[model samples]
Target chain A: MKKSVILSILSVFLITIFLGGCGSKDQTTLNVYNWGDYIDSSVIKQFEKETGIKVNYDTFATNEEMYVKINKGNASYDIAIPSDYMIEKMIKEGLVEKIDFNNIPNYQYIEDRFKNLEFDPTNEYSVPYMWGTLGILYNKKMVDEPVDSWDILWNPKYEKQILMLDSQRDSLAVALKKLNYSMNSTNDAELEAAKNALIEQRPLVLAYVGDEVKDKMIGEEAALAVVWGGDAVTMHRENPDLEYVIPKEGTNLFVDSIVIPSTAKHKAEAEKFIDFLCRTDIAFKNTDYIGYSTPHMEARKQLDPELANSPIAYPEPEDLENAEIFIDLGTYIEQYNRVWTEIKSH
Target chain B: MNKKWISAPYLVWMVIFIVVPLFLVGFYGITVRTDTGFVFSLEPLQRCFEPTYLKVLGRSVLLAAISTVICLILGYPIAMILTSKDFSDKNIYLMLFVIPMWMNFLLRTYAWLTLLEKNGLINVLLQKIGLNPIHILYTNQAVVLGMVYNFLPFMVLPIYSVLKKLDSSLIEAAQDLGANGFQTFIKVIFPLSIPGVVSGITMVFMPAVTTFVISRLLGGGHYYLIGNLIEEQFLSVGNWHFGSALSIFLMIIILISIFITSHYETDKEGSVGLW
Candidate 1:
């Protein structure tokens, strides 16, 4: 019995010693957290080659997920890519740190159109990475009609073949747009209208989708989808029959911006990477790979003409007039999420 | 031979796995704050009772109840057959039932997703059979199908064990007393299988009620559940207190289920406590 006890104690000690050795901490490694499939990873390798900062990249599905990781105070991410409303919300809570413009010389390459947006006035806290609208993408073969309106998604004809956005903000924005309501409306009556519209459309929806809609739609599994412009671009890349169209009614124009969360230890390295991403060539590469429109004017010129010409990638200025940026709803966000939950559960 | 040996190890395991986590859950439940930086309160609990979470709870109970009923009805006969005298290779049949449980539950769920999905094998086969390719995925039916498939093995194992231990003489005596096969089964076999049924129901129903992954992948993530609420609170919204409260709420519901199911069995099983 003593021998067995000794053996067990020895085993435990050896295992603890070996496992403890694996917990190595180094100051050189910069941990980056961003949206999944958001950035071209090749650019990260290039940045690593240029500067010997070992970059550990991780991805989250939503802005709130990133916020949870940062705010909960476990993960120490150097850089974060959150959208406009999230940026505003983070800024309000002082969860983001001010950017030092001197570190990022290539910030000048970013287009004036994307700069000084409402989320980050004077581009102080965040840099615009990529921007796009939420819209309809349908198969040209299956959908013979012009498919100009959001109402087409509500039609009974495509009952089992329709895909809607799964994200709370994007999905809710679409519903709000369908009812001719403001994308950022915090009013209860307008929200109720959107909720009722969603409930009506629920029976007709095939799936509430995120990135997977791209693959499922092109494969003809789903005939019509409410997808992000970036995902629509990716789907169209593989299949030429796939066509993306903005609903005649307006949609939410969103910009995902790179910001340093308050918990960042490597703010210097993050700022440098953001600067690297802003370089016209790098931005163009990222845009080409990820299929999101680069917010840089110089990058637009460098983009392939086919991509540049796609209305889905870059809508005309007239089509853009009615598009509104999402604003932080503050206290009303709870109500919005509640409404979202109620609509979904029922 | 030795109750102490069994009791000691069982107690140790319970303390390590169940009791420890439950204590931590209580610790986190009161300590973690809401997104607005407020400390633990009844606010999250109040939020949980809101129509949104209640509807989620309602759907979860509905899906779980239906799945339990379906599994028992399907699993009982298969378990009975496996335990029957006609089946010579009991070990082989038992292993066959047990083997599918060895695969990851998530992978099994995904396999069903592949089957239920549009352009999946089912739809393709339907088209081949000259029938209209039906829309099966992202519906309540798909969610129930996933639950039944995943929990069917769980339902089978308990009933098989009980039926295997069933005395042959009891059924024979029922037959000798002028009862037909159907009457013998109803009077002896079916009544004797209640413990197994109760245990199987307990196992499948609890997991089903709290399950969100299967529903998310198969039902398209639109159908929110209490499990989803807990996930959103802890992982998404960073409200650990709320998540803990939600978990405790699930635990209370589970306890209530056990109490109700136990009461159902008590009237029938008199002295035989289902172990």
Candidate 2:
């Protein structure tokens, strides 16, 4: 029995040594949580190969899902990407960690315009990854009239041919803008009017879509879809018949930023990954692949000149004069939830 | 040898997976977070009785019932045909019916979306045939069609198995007692197949009542069912207390359905249980 036990122990030790040699014992692992389809996965592989750190990546469909998981504190995630208002909420709720820019030397590559935004005014918690605006993606073959206003979404002529965003804030922002109200208006009467407008538009809507909007648009399933500028760019690439435009009433401008959650297991590795992502070449590669507007000055110079000069990618200041960014709604968020649920139930 | 100990692992799994999670749901359903700690509160449960929620509940039940009844009407004849003495290659027929179910349920439902879209396959074919293209993708009828298509197999299989085992002696006796084809079916085959019908109803109704994907994908997210409400509470709104309360309400509905089904089952076969 003793000899058999010694043989088994010897085999186990040998296996362990072989495995340890295959994957170095000192290699650290990082867990990243971000929005679905938000990244070029090849960058993750590059990061892994360069740093010898294994990455466990997961994606969320909405900010609420990421917030709930972080709020529960059940799972430890090293890094997370959330939009502007959601980043503010996470900072307020103490669910995120403050970044130490000393470790991220590439932070210098970020443009001055994106440095001190409303979401992270002090530049303490988050780093801007991508910025986009909401707009309409219309098929030229299907839409006969000018598509300059959000009112066309409510037009009866396009009944069952209109696709709206499924997101609460995004959808509500559309309704709010169509009524000539601020996208972030907290006035009860304004919110009520927005709610009524959505209810009146519901019958004409083909569907309230999420990421599927891209596939449906590419498939020519609908005439018009309310989509983000990034998705519109990607979809328009696949179907040249499609055109994107920010309505005359204006729309929400959003910035999604990267942050480390408080429950991060590898804070140092997470910082390294963030810094790697901010590198000029890496930033350019990611922006080129994801088709989102980059906030890195050096990265923007490397982008396709045609794309960089396009108004949709670099809109003139006067064109976006009425554009508004979402701020943390805090307790008033519940009121939005109530209005949304009421609209849906109606 | 005592076999009771062999069941210990199963019992442990049940307690851990089923009982504990249900207890936790009940706990969350009745409690609200306070400054100090959680406190007992009925507000969440009471919120379920609101007019908006009640309307969602009514629509869920009404849609599920319509789908279940349609399944019965369509499935009964199919099951009868499959079990008939004149039918040949019975296994092949049953296999053909179940083959569609072998694919992923979500994929099948998604296929229906592409087929029924305004410019999808069905509409294109209709245009070629000189028929007006019907608007059927995002309506309540489309949701029912999805449910009926997906759950028809559940309704047919149970009834088919029961009808297959039916004693021919009873039917012959009914025929000998001066009964016509319809009379024999009403008096004999239908009465004896109650168990299968009951189980079929339970199977079809349970899934139909709680389906969120069909309603969301095919109904275009305009219509809110109870399942959709529960999903919104947990996923989008992050209202665990309210979500738990809604879940408990759905559980109660399922329990009541099972009770009513088993009650009639026992009335017919005293010791028989619901599957």
Candidate 3:
């Protein structure tokens, strides 16, 4: 009985290995890595149906998590949707491939304003996917005062009723902007003040949250939260009592863009996928479902007029005048890490 | 089939998955990368001893120790009750403890969030009962509660198995010698169960100290445990050297704890008996 069992097991293992070797022989598979819940599932099905290319879709929670995986060179990811700062970092490190814009004719649908940004100044390495501003999402019933300025977050009456972003850069940016300093300030004194401000505000924060900020704000678990404009849009849909505001002081204007890593084996197919995502109907489907601001002008027009005109989703230029895009901090990131650790440990 | 051949696949799996990763972690822990190449450096390990990190390590140990003790206090009685001769439905009661564990650990923890949030079910129930709602979530207490709830099974199963195999003749001899129930438990049963208790504490304490999720979900990110510090280094900061160093240091602490507990477990002379 034992001999027969061993023989069967060995045969099964050999058969599995043989089948796995044959499975990838003929098919052109594209590996797409994106943020969790960033895409509409139907779009992937449609793309596969139209192109007959198999897609291995995976998701990451943060830009850092995605960076480490790609940097390790363990997996050959064909496409990645990383934010502007990360694209800049990847480009500097020679990790990303320059896009062949000729293959991406749908790239013209992207707004001109989203192009020629600081991260990819020549617009060579990446194509804009979505863009938004970081701001405060507050409950109208919980607070009685005007919520226009970042100063309101420091109000003592809202103690233990505020939720700060758990992310280091975003949280520090809020403090930096509130002090009338640049969000990208690397100076010791400026960062020290930001650190001190966060340490003081730590007592007032109910929780340092990430994706849970939306659920908590909608449930009225917290009166105020630091959230991305996109998340704020989703939270408002769930609870109309919630309101989003771009603080008058300034905020981080972030743009997530699609880039092909240099390690990608299927570059041409990845470019095709990027063009598919940029198409008007597909872009509209994604932006509508994901609730992020669409950088595709045609897609924006196709959205509900109420949503298309909403200042939260599509903030006017003057409102973004003070907003600064985050840049790769290089080794200066250690300082922010230190300050964050101190604040969290304290 | 030969025994060695039968175990060959498992041995390969262990070396590839366990030994190789551990070796890599150790390599990164003690080395620093520089302009030329990797060099032997203790900076990452030394950084772990800094005041901030030391406090994080101290908090992790303190909370894990608290949770282990709570599990022991609660679990011992349950194991004793289940192993008692009068308990006829022991399997049914044991199944009750194991059932929740069959569900995903993350899902179970997430469920607690719904019950513990500000306007969550617990608060709603409290308000309806004319009692002020308690702020129990997002606190160290909640983290400890989560640890105890999740790890109680680990503590109970080992003790229950030990007690089940305990010789009945020993108890009968103590009773024949005119010893009462309390005296018999203190002098005979408790000392004999030292191995089980030691293993139980080891299982519960080790995981509790290294748990990032429970503290993250329950402690509201306010309580920065060592696990969270290590996680931030690896995931957010991309500082693998520091993260590996922290992991190595945590492993050493766990090894020392297991060493101490195993010493008690091997002292079969009944030296652990209460006088």
Candidate 4:
């Protein structure tokens, strides 16, 4: 009886909060949806405190979930953060609206290099959030030499000590990049090569993981991993002995960007929030907390000196040039799926 | 049972929570339109058995089968102990098994990763305890362990309820016929408990097949079950048509198998079904 009563109270409480969040259509409210643990939570509260606009925040684990959720409904979201490849796909599918550049005067705060890229070529639709290369975060204390490239990971010496990403795209992209192939390669033969590499590499994998690799990598549980850049930064700080290296043969350089969906009801508020987030102070806070590289130019200058010098957070200019950005592969998805199937099955 | 206005609300709550979401799931699944104002096509249901797709189906069935058998073997004894009434601290035992489940499913699976990885807790403990550490996390063993661990409660509770409801007199009657303990169990308790066993099996197998998180987390992309494939198609590929086809086919396969099982079991028992 008590349990049921408690549940009733909880339900009422939740409903009240949810209803309160659903503000008057005339009043300003901004809904920002991002990947879980993507930014500094404190900054969000600060934004709401200062701006007087209610913020509805939610999180998803992957790009696909964000994409599907936004496109599948009467979207409650005003702003969403999706990675480069997904942003490209969103643009192609017409799921996102072009940003009104005037509402976002702070767009000039972004770095020069990130200005015009494949996903949203003219910065018309998105603002870069966090950027990083997918690569091995290795323990210097355990391994011999500076972990130069992807081949070093495939080396037999690292067997059972190496972790791979659980993601199909990131894992396969590493293999694809190793073979001097584009991470976005839709060519069946190229995908097949990546598949074969994974099949061979699978037996040697210690484990495939996501953010928890940051914990395991720093805890000295695994010597190395194919990890996301933000996760690598977290790992590196945990143990200075750990280092993140983009492979010599090239690796994935990607960014998560904030965009407004076409179905968004509160576009003006969303743009306000985006412009607020782009402000150097807030952007810097997000970067400092998340430990991933921010694309915001002036915000980056505010990062701690030690963190600013970390190569994982800011890969060398040459390394950035060699790195490939993943773009949407529309119809050839079947072939990638097909190759991924064989790799996993075998 | 509480009050006039308040009591009326629970009935409304159950329907809204249970009936409404289910209605939405069914409604959107079959008849929803695309974002572009395009009417959703049955095209999502078309490619259910492309050879590649069939392989995923076969894999889901196999994974579920293995998990169900393991759950059966592991769960029965545990459930028996809990319902035995002879066992002290039965609630404690149940809680030990259930506390892990109460935690986030994803977190528990990841906890397995921390234990099973090469230099993880199990290995470190093994080595510290002067035994060789084994690679256990990414293997099929880890995947099955995670599944059985996650779904074991589903298997346990039903069987425990059935066991608790069992009449001691029935087993004694069989034993008075000069039957051994095993024979008495086989003849009376086993048959009587079939309903719970079947319910447990269905509960375990159905969701076990559909679980994407465990296979990806513990199987380490080394395994590709049907759920993962469906996820890949819909999310990664953005090929909604193909994904829809796969989902519809999976639903059909589930529906048909369930139909056949329900009919066959009911006919065999002249009444009982998994439901």
- Chain B TM-scores, listed for every candidate in order, come to 0.88, 0.95, 0.96, 0.82
**lDDT for each residue of candidate 2 in B1-275, tens digit (9 for 90 to 100):** 36889999999999999999999899989999888989999988999999988889989999999999999999999999999998888889999999999997877988898899878999999999999998888889999999999999999999999999999999999999999999888767887888888899999999999999899888988899999999888877888899899889988999998898778866765423322
How many residue pairs collide in each prediction? 0, 0, 0, 3
Worst 10 residues of 4 chain B by lDDT: B266-275
Residue B57 CA error for candidate 1 (Å)? Answer: 1.9
lDDT of 1 at B55: 80
Ten-residue region with minimum lDDT total, candidate 2 chain A: A1-10
Candidate 1 has an lDDT of 0.83
Query: lDDT of each prediction vs. the true structure?
Result: 0.83, 0.88, 0.91, 0.78
Whichever of 1 and 4 has more lDDT, that candidate is: 1
lDDT of 1 by residue, A1-346 (tens): 1222233355457546744786655536677877777777688789878987767776777777778888876888889899999999999999999999999998888888889899888679999999998788899999989988899988999887898877778888888888888989989999989888999999888887666676688788888998889888899888888988888788889999999988888888988888988988899899999898888888989888988878889999887777889999987887787777777788
Q: Candidate 4: misplaced stretches above 4 Å?
A: A1-27, B1-46, B85-104, B251-275
Q: State how far residue B251 of model 3 sits from its true place (Å).
A: 1.0
When summed lDDT is taken over every stretch of 10 residues in candidate 1 chain A, the lowest stretch is: A1-10
* DockQ (CA atoms), all models: 0.57, 0.63, 0.74, 0.43
Higher-TM-score candidate among 2 and 4? Answer: 2
Q: Which ranking of candidates, highest DockQ first? A: 3, 2, 1, 4
Q: For model 1 chain B, where is the 10-residue window of minimal lDDT?
A: B266-275
Which candidate ranks first by TM-score, i.e. highest?
3
For A215-321, candidate 2 gives per-residue lDDT tens digits of 78999889999998987878878999999989989888889999999999899999999999999989998998888888988998999998777677677777687
Instruction: Give the TM-score of candidate 3 (chain A).
Output: 0.92
- lDDT per residue as tens, model 3, B30-75: 9998999889999999999999899999999999999999999999
Q: What is the DockQ of candidate 4?
A: 0.43
Clashing pairs in 3: none
> Quality of candidate 2's docking, in CAPRI categories?
medium
